[model samples]
Target chain A: MRETGRPLLAWVGLAARLVTGIVWIVAGGLKITQPDASINAVRAYQLLPSSVAEVVGIALPATELVVGLALVLGVFTRGAAVMSAVLFAAFIVGISSVWARGIEIDCGCFGGGGTKAGAASAYPWEIARDTALLAASLLVASLRRTRLSLDSLLFATRPAERAATEGAMT
Target chain B: MSSNSKASARAQKAAEMRAAQNKREARRRILTIAGVLGVMVLIVGGSIGVSLLNKEDVKAAGAGSSEYGVTIGESDAPHSVVIYEDFLCPYCGQLERATRKDLARLAADGKVFVEYRPFDLLSSIADYPIRATNAFAVVLEKSGPDVAKKFHDLLYENQPSEQDPGSMTDDDLVKLAVEAGATEGDVRADIEGLAQQAWVDKATQEAADSGVKSTPTILLDGKVFQDGRTIQDMADNLMAELE
Candidate 1:
C-alpha cells in the first residue's frame, strides 16, 4: 500500500481521463448532429459491408458519448479508459488502411475538420495520442485507490484496530 | 507483553487494515468497471438497432444518388459534356442560365451531348432529398434527353431559396416531366420504379470515384474543365482536341 507514491499516478490518470473524455464527447456530439455524414464516413472506409457500416456508424458515436461521460464523471475510470484505448486503436487502423490505399481523405475522427497532409493521413500522430492515453488508463486501472475516489474513502483501513493491538502488546 | 512484541502486533494490524482497504477498493473498482462496460454494451447495441431501422429512411431520402454514371447524353453526339450540379448551389444555377443558349445551339446541331449528375452541396445545411438528381435520372431513363433537359431547366428556373427545403414530390416531378414532353405513363412508371433510385446511387458513387468533390464540375471528354471559359472558349478547346 504505497499510498504516498501513488499520487503522481493518480494525477496522470486524471489528466488522461479528462483529455480522452472531452475529445470523445465532442467528437460523438458532432457525429450525433450528422448521423448521415458519419454513415458516409464509415462507408468511405470500405472495411465493412454496407449493412455493417450503417450499424457501426450509429453505434460508434453513441459509444463515444457514453464512455466519454463515464470518464468525465470519474466513475468507472478504468472501464472508460479501456474503451477509449480500444476505440482509438481501431481508428488508427482504419485511417492507416485508407492512407495505404493512397486515399487522401479526412479520417472524420474529430468530425471532418482536422485533416492534415502526408503521414498525417496515415495518422501516426493519432495512434501515438491514443497509445499514450492507453498507457495512462492502464496505470489508473492498476492504481485503483486515488484520494478523491469513493473506493478510497469506503475502503480506508481501521487505524483504531492498529492502536488497540499496539497497546495490548505493549 | 514486550514493547517490541506490541510494536509487531500494531504493525500486523496495520497491515491487515491496509489489506482490507485494498480489497474493498479493488472490489469497488471491479464493480464500477463492470457497470460501465454494461452500459457501453447497451448503448452500442441500441445504436446499432436504431441505425438499421433508419436505413430505410436514409435510402428513401436518397443519400447516395449524386454520383456519376453513364453519360445519359444524346446517343448520336460525337462528344459529351458532363455537368455535376447541385440544386442548392447558386454557381450551378448560374452556369445553367449563362450557358443555356450555347447548350441549346450545340444540342440543335446534334454535335454535342450533355449529361447531368446531381451533387448535394447543401446536405450539411438541410435534409433535402437527392431527388433533383433522382428526378433527372428518371426523366432521362423514361423520356430521353429532351425531357431531361426540359426538367433540368424547370428545376433551375423554379429553384428555391437556399434556406428553404426544396424538394419535389412524385406528382410535382411527374407534372414537370409531362410538361417536358414525357408521356404520363412513362413518367409515372419511371418515378415509381426503384431502379431509377439505384441508378442515382450508382451515378453518385461514380462521381465520387472520378474525384468530383464540388458542384458544377464540368468534364469535357473525360478531362475536368477547370475554366469552362466562354462558350467560344469551350468550343475552341473542343475543336482543338478534335483536330
Candidate 2:
C-alpha cells in the first residue's frame, strides 16, 4: 500500500465505472438494432402497465447507449452513474418481481430477453449481476475524481498537476 | 483584550465559513443541473436518431405486400394457415419437416391456403438467418412463388447446423437455385444483391410487430393452435379448428 501510493478504493471505482459502461453499451447496442425485440423483452417483464411498458421499452436502449457512452468517456460520470444505478435498480426489481410471480423468462440483459419455460430459478443470478452493477454505479458516483476523467481535466488548472494526479492508469 | 469582542470575532469567522460552504453547494447544484440537461438531450437525440434509422430501413425495403405472408394456395380456399418461420432455427426446421407434406396436401386440395411468412428472431444472434431471409425475398421477387417454394425447401434440406459458423453464402444459395432448375436470368443477380437486406429487415420487423416471438409459429385462421405437439395432433387440431 505504501509503495503503490494510491488508494485501492479509487482503482476499484474506476474499474467499476468502465465495466458498467461496457455492459450498458453492449446491451443497448444489441437491443437498438432490434427495436421490436427490445420492446418484446420489456413486455416479457409484465411488470409495468402495457402502455408504460411500451414507453420504457422504446426509450430504454437509447438511454442506455447515451449513459454508457457518457460513463465510458468519463464525461458526466456522476450523472451517468446516476442513470446506471437507477436502471440496474429497476432491473433488479423487475427480475425479483417476476421470479416471485413464477414467471419464467430470460432477463433480456442481452439480446434474447424473452419469456420461456424452465428459467425461473435463474432469477437470483440475474439479480446478483444487477446488484453488482448498482454498487459499481454508486461507487463511481461517490468518487470525487478518477484518472483520465473529464471531471479531473476540468478541475486541474496546470498540465503538471493534471499529469501528476491522474494515477488511475490501471 | 475584551472577552465580548473576542467572542464576536469568532462568531464572524463561523458565519464566513458557512457562507463558503453554501457557495460550494450552489456550484455543485449548477453542475448537477447541467448534467441532467445534458443527459436528457442525449436520450431524446438518440431516440430521434433511432426512429430515423427505422424509417430509412423501412423505406428502402421497397414494394412488399402489406397483406402479410407469402401465398401458397388459392385465395378462395375456405381455410387459412399461416406459418411464421426462421430458416436457421432448429425447431422451425423440425416443424417444417414434420408438417411439410400435410401442409402441401392441405394446399393442393383447396381446403386451406398456406402462407409461409418468413419471420426472423435468430438473425441478431447469427448472420445466417437474416441473410437467408433476404435470399428468400430475392427469390420470391424474381422467380415467382413456386420457384421460391423450391428454394425454401432446398435451403431447409441442406441447412447447416445452428452452431455452424460458416452458414451458406448467397452465392451457394444462387447455385442451389440454378441446380433446382431456376432460369438463371437475373435470379442469381437478385440473390447476390444487397438491396434485399432492407427487405429482410422489414419482413422481420413486420413479424415482430405482429407478436411472432419464436420460429414455426403456426396459426390456423389467425388463431394459434396451442394443444398440438406432433403431426397427428396438429392435424387433429386443424380439423377441429375447421369446425
Candidate 3:
C-alpha cells in the first residue's frame, strides 16, 4: 500500500508540475511578443498605478516563462510551484476585485486583456480556472518527490541515506 | 558483550554523521533555491528597467491637444456621446454601419455632442489600423472633421476582413481620402507617407490608458453604455436618456 501510494502521488505531482508549467509558458509566450497589448491589458485592470503597471507588464511575461521552465524541468519544483500559486492567487484577487467594482475587463490570462464587451460574464470562469491552477500548484509544492525530474537527478539521495531510508520504509 | 557494545556505538556514530550530512544537504538546497529566487528577482527588475528605457516616445500631431477628438456637433450640446473605435475591428465596423446615419442626424440637430475617437488598437495584429488611423488623422488635420468623417465612413465601407487586411494598401487609403473630398496632392502624399503615425500611436495609448479595452465602446454622458446589446436597443436607450 505504501509503495503504491508513494509512486502514485509522485506521478500526480509530476502531472501537476507539467500542467502548470505548460500553461505558464503558453501565457507568457503569447504576451511576450506584444508588449503594448500586455501593458494595455494591465492598464485595463486599473488596479495598479501606471508606472507599476508598466513594470509588471514588462516583467510578468519573462517571469512566467522562467518559472514555467523551472517547473517543467523540475529543477526547482517547490519554488516554481510557490511562484505559480502566487500568480494564480493574484489573478483571482484581480478578477474578484474587478467583479466587485463592476468593471468590465478580460482577465487576460493567456493574452489580449482589455475592456471587452460582455466581459463581466466571464469573471466567474476565470476565477474558477485560476483557483484550480492554485490547487495544482499547492499540490506540486507539497509533493516534492516527483518522477522523471531534474530534481531527482541533481539531488539524488546518497547511497547510505538511500539504503537507510529504504530499510526504514520496509 | 564488549564487542556488541562497540558495534552499537559505531552504528550510532554513523547515524549521527549521516544526519549531519543530510542537514547540510538540506541547507544547501535551501540556499540554492534562495539564490535562484534572487536571480529571478534581478531578471524582473532588469527587464522593467530595460522596458522603461526602451519605450517609444509619442510624438503625434494631436499629442498634447485638449480637443483632439473628431467632433460632430456643438461643444455645448446637452447630450454627449463618445464612440471609441478601431478600423480593424469587425464589431466597430458593424456598430458604425448600424448607427452612423442616426448619430450624424442627432449631431446635426444640435441635440448631442458626438465624438469619434479613432485609434489603432490592433496595430499588433495588422498594419491597416495604424495606417487607416494615420490617414484619418491627416484628413482631420488638413481637410477638417467633416471631410475626415466622410473618410472614416469610406474606410469602414471598404473594411477588409481580419484575415486579409493586407488587401487595403497605402494607395487605397489615399484614394479613399481623395474620394472623401481631400485634394489629390499633399493630402494624398500625407496619407501615403503615414504623416500621422505617431499621433495614431499616441491616441492608441491614450485609449488604453482610459480603459477602452475593446473597439466600439460607446459612452453616453461620460459613462460606459450599458443599455443593451443590440444597436436598436442602445439607440432607444440613448434617446430615452436624452429625452
Best by TM-score: 3
Pick by DockQ: 1 or 3, better one:
3
Which parts of model 2 have CA positions greater than 4 angstroms off? A1-6, A155-170, B1-44, B55-243
The DockQ leader among the candidates is: 2
Tell me the TM-score of each prediction against the true structure.
0.46, 0.48, 0.53
lDDT of 1 by residue, B1-243 (tens): 999999999999999998897787688657755775687678666655554554422111111123343334354677667677776665567677766666667756776666666755555555343666677777777777667778878878766545465454666767877888888886686665534667666766665665555556666655655332232344455445433
Candidate 3 matches the true fold with a TM-score of 0.53
lDDT string, candidate 2, B34-60, tens digits? 875676687767774774365211111
lDDT of 3 by residue, B111-196 (tens): 88778888987776678898999999999898888898899999999998776789999999989999999987858888888888
Q: What are the candidates' interface root-mean-square deviations?
A: 11.4, 8.1, 8.1
What ranking emerges by DockQ with the best candidate at the front? 2, 3, 1
DockQ of candidate 3 is 0.12
Show pairs that collide, candidate 1: B66-B204, B67-B203, B67-B204, B68-B203, B68-B207
Q: DockQ for the candidate 2 complex? A: 0.13
TM-score of chain A of 1: 0.75
Q: Model-by-model lDDT, in order? A: 0.62, 0.71, 0.78
Cα lDDT of model 3 by residue, A61-146, tens digit: 87888788788988878888999999999989989988997767777778778765457888898899889999999999988578
**lDDT score at residue B45, model 1, on the 0-100 scale:** 66
